[model samples]
Target: MPAGKGEKQPYFHCKKLNSMMKNPKPYFLLCAALIVVSFPTWSLSKTATHLDLVKLKNGTVLEGHIVSQTARSLNLENVGGMISILRESIDRVITAEPGESAMFLGAQLLERKKFARAEFFLKIAAEYPAWRTESNASLQKLNTIKEQLEEQRREKEKSDIEKLIRRKGVEAGISELERRHSAEDDYWGSVRGRLHLLMARERLDHYDLKMAEQHLTLAEKYGVTKEQWESVRNEIVAMRRKSLLYGEDKLASRAFQSRKRPDKTAAGGGLLALAGEAKKKGEKVPPLEWLELVDRYAGENDVDPLLIWALIDTESSWRSQVVSPKGAQGLMQLMPLTAKDLEVDNPFDPEENIRGGIRYLRFLLKMFKDTDTALAAYYVGPGRVERYNGIPPAGREYVQKVRTREAALNKRFGLSPQGRTLSKS
Candidate 1:
């Protein structure tokens, strides 16, 4: 298509004067360059360039002009070149009238606080000399906003962690801390370092020398200065000497007992209670063959294992071969479609089902950013949750049941919502 009205004409046009090249191309190029130099900023504001978008099913999106189309394929032309795309591969297409500047569109989207889309447009604008400075400035501002949002999210997580610690005790805090601070990701290392130091001090105060030393070592690795924790380390050494001299005292043994007692058959209060009550009624509780798989994938995906446990219990009652009335299968009860999407060939296999189900849970958690809503999505479907902007009415009971089970598991394991008994002291 020719340039829009009031826009500069292309320096080269085909199908004219026996070839449209009767005039020298270099002369036309010079003329085009002069026109570009003389182009006014005010004229750019008047002409807001529009582009077409072809979004593919595999998440590749092409931004360009659809130059031509046939029944099975369409051709797109962009700065890159003309390319053909099969209709079968296309997910959706969006077309806009050709006329706006990328900078203008970026600024408009930025005003709407649509950061991701705005960043795309701003990046395009930044490539041109005329718009580079302004576009780069906008990009910087967008980055600042993203950083601020991240900081706010971290703050909210900290607040939630504090509340969980208050309600469930230090073990809960440790579990949450481990869930959020992985050694591979050091963004939260310093914060974790300080917390570990604090926990180590508490352990020392309680005369739990082993856990205290463990926390101290973790704190050092996480960025705590040796000097900052030297005194704590010294105390740990002194306590160790005392223990060696006197042998494992009753108080020390009691501290160990305090941590170990929660793992006892009778004291395993959470999900075990469910199994116990079922046994009391002569109802058979399914074997928990997938528990180890759940732990593995949950850690890999940074999901709360207790949540996965609750979901599995609610989905299939720990029966590896169970099939739901709706045709969902296995311990995690994966539907055939979901199983396929997760690349699980055998959904009834305990390991496959648990891995796929936990991964799905992780995806939902990231998409919805709330456990309850994500659980609702997990039960009903993400589309329904998104349509309702939260947990749908049909999924309320399912979410509630899973949450209740999660809390019970928390009690049973004596850990936080994210299950793990690191540092007993």
Candidate 2:
């Protein structure tokens, strides 16, 4: 006979039971004893197989499967379907199979596209062969998806960089590239080297020779070709020599213009011309009286005297009574407001002016922590440098000029260890 739905079939066949009918009394007694002994064991085994134990702080106990848990709550599957219990209300959960619990959680995370976390639990689940094959397949798929997403991100980044270069020009583009290079996990050294070389050329175009040299050095470090390096090196040397000659001529011309009286003009012009000639003959000119004052203040402020000399040379050409068209005065070209802030009563006084300027320069150096940026802030304004994220376009030449003059003065005085300019442009 066929068994009905939800009915338990008898263990013995009807024909075998008919054979036992001859000894019906003994068979009935045996059947009753078997039921008495096996029922409790069957019930115990069934309860152990299907349920997890949950104990609560309120002295309540529950038997159910744990569906999921978070920091604040737990989802449980019970005979009542599903129930959410606040973690604060629960004391402990005793699951039947830890491996099965991990496998369930991993599957949930996989569905949510949390690939990294999913892989972690899935790897643990893989210790059980029942979950190993599915977990492995999911891990492979997760890796593939991650790779595709990364490739798409890189393509978008490259496209954006091209647009930036075209729209904002090389300096802005290089700034963006540097920011991205620092943040990216897989940085492209070749691309960075090419961008650095482009920036070096731009600096050269602006006559920022020291900055160009630094960029070229970085380019070589990042993998510029040797032939390209040599060509750039030759260009830098030629440009530097031309720049030095031009600077000397400009200084002499400015000195000639500073003297208004005819008698003093000839003497001043002659002295300036003699200085130029002496420089050409590789002879050192006598130091200005103001140099001693600058050294004293710079030392007192722990600032570089050569840097002050460069600033003075660029600002007023070492003229104590000179004033700029912009109303900056004295040897250090202190503006009226800045002079007041520095407590300088007379901007015409060389000692007071140099002291105020050196104090300000030291402040800028400490604030920016880079020589080029500090000079840029001094030349334009700190606000402008902050706005531009570096030296402003208008001030690049000024920064380069000051750094170039500083290098020269340092070399002449043997103040720098390497006898080379240290520009952080």
Candidate 3:
């Protein structure tokens, strides 16, 4: 009674479709599962082969292409660069397992100086072991490029550096320039070093031989190498001889005319006065909490007491309780790993922290040459900071602030009845 298609039998297509519509859940679930299973493989296959890495738990990572792949060790293109982390030493790969790969591609891109591109690839490469070696290479290379870029910025910035010279003072200029040498940039101090050389030159220009000798001595103390130092010394000696023989009064005014100090409390100098003034306010130098403890610890290590004092002031404002967002701690703000390496029983203790901080400073000095470079290290974790080619924002502020305090110490001691250390007769 109900079927009336000219009294025809039920349609087979309608029957099959009606049956499917009755329970479509299985079909829907199967389609979704296929997508879920296939998506990652598609994503992986989509990667273009350029830079790749094989990660190993052993101290080494491999950088090259995946010439072949299995769950186990993959073939790497080249194995040697200067560092020991080179490829010849990769004894094992993921325990020689099968059907496995981890490639850090983005890191590899960075090595090629494709930062924007590397940034994209590296983000993905982080997901695979093959990319780790490349990723690390990329990071190291990227940092190197960043520094190169920063240095390129400075050559055009000579006038800016010169303007800063008046504000940064002798110490600031020294600090800034020395940092460049240590960072492998070698440009920051070039101009100032020239100025210092000019001091010797001006002395020779005039016949005031004695004053020139003193100024030359100061220049050498600022970090010129023995070659540069001896050269300056010889020039000074030669000029004195010439002046004595040829004439005196002609250039006399030139030698006698020394450059005047600019404003006392400008640039980095303002901070320098603060440390001393803090004492006047009844807040002890290095703070009573840190001063005694620093001496006890620093003296034990044969480290310079003043250098430790300077580092702490720069690192954490002498606050034993301070902590950086990066988890650096104490008056000296040692990163936890560094604290462990230095064997500080308690990183927060003023004595131990200063001791470790000073040791670290000494290490940095040997690593980079002079207090200025060391100060940069303490402020931003050593020569790595030079990757930015100059003082980073934090490092710049830290250095100025510390130098200001050190300057205050110099002033206080200079005026004190005790006076500074005396030269041997």
Candidate 4:
């Protein structure tokens, strides 16, 4: 029907369609049909100022002027003329608002594969209804890809660790693993367990049963398998049995029992008081089974008990049965000849070793008249100290370790360098 004066024309009616339908020539009906199917294009002003950005669910962004809209669809006029878009396929609609233009910037960054910056802007733009769905979907997809890449990197690192262990040694593998995981606070439990197992095995090879057992406990806590735990445990038990069978544990146990005890008054009440106060303050006194034995012999030989404790800790880490590769045995690492000259019947005996080591250190202290020089003489020999007229180059590190350990022990026991108990400030 044609509209009368002041009456509005229906949106579907067009003059071009009417002309073609009325002519009725060959192809006239077909031409009219084409016009009817595509007659809803509004003659909107083709300018950037009047455009809306339509973002599709599939991440396609279309810039055009919205010609008309119905309840379920909208008509857009771009360079391609009229496109009818279903409302369900559209993710968002950005009108020609000034700030809404930045929503498309995230899409551009995403196209360039700059995911971090893309996510940042996308998150900001997602605050509005115009860009929420697309932004969140993009973030989810980006996170998935990032997680995949991180997994690949971790897998590659694990492969490298295996290669390093095979080519070099377990120590090399442990160094590499520790270097990588040092920055991570919460690493995967399985990987941490593997690291602990490696350390346990290494310590076992070195015959450090105490450290090996400690690492094994940590390994099991982290997630090591029962089989691996059993294997390390058996090794530790075997090593301990070997030490006992050689009379190493027996002689040490007997010597410790036979050692003389120091009188609290003779050794100075301050030292005993410091230990008691440290215990009351919930501090761990340095772990030495023969601490009073050390004090008794050190007092007899005119040596500092703390210095003796430091030497024992550094030389053998408190393992009474440990023997060095150089044939130095016991907590003090006394060589066979040194043990003989000092009249130590069994170098593995803790009491004899401690007394002999304290006597030898006292002689060195009197001869060298310097604590560091005496420590250096103890590590390398009095002959080496005499040849160099001071601590040798190799013995400097030994001297430093002993002195550092002595200082730590002093702090631990609340003692000062002048043999007086230090008061807490």
What lDDT does the true structure give each of the candidates?
0.67, 0.65, 0.55, 0.66
List the candidates ranked by lDDT, beginning with the highest: 1, 4, 2, 3
Residue-level lDDT tens digits of model 4 in 192-256: 45545666765565555667766676667556677887787667655555444444456445545
Task: Write down the worst ten-residue block by lDDT for model 2.
Answer: 416-425
Tens-digit lDDT string for candidate 3 (1-425):
45766775543448766565678788779889999998875654433343445565665565553434333223443322111122333455432211122233344445565454454345445555444454555566677888899888877566655766899776777676665456432322332233345556555655556656555555554445667766766675455444444455745655446433222222233323444456788876656545655545554434555556666666687788899986889988887856764557899887778777766665565546566666776666643555655456767777777778767766654433122211111
- Model 2: colliding residue pairs: none
Total backbone collisions for each predicted model: 9, 0, 22, 0
The true-versus-predicted C-alpha distance at residue 413 of model 2, in Å, is 3.9
Which TM-score value belongs to model 1? Answer: 0.35
Model 2 ranges with Cα > 4 A deviation: 1-287, 418-425
lDDT of 3 at 128: 59
Give the alpha carbon lDDT tens digit for every residue of 1-425 in model 2: 77898887655668677568656888899999999998765543211133466799988987655656667666664433335566778898888664555555556666687654466566766786655666676678778888998899989988888899899998887888777765322223133454456657655765666577666766675666778776776676555544444653564456456533212122223333434555678786434446556645665556665677788889888778988886789888877866764558999987899888887777667657898888887777665666677778978999989989877865554444222212111
* Model 2 residue 370 CA deviation in Å: 1.2
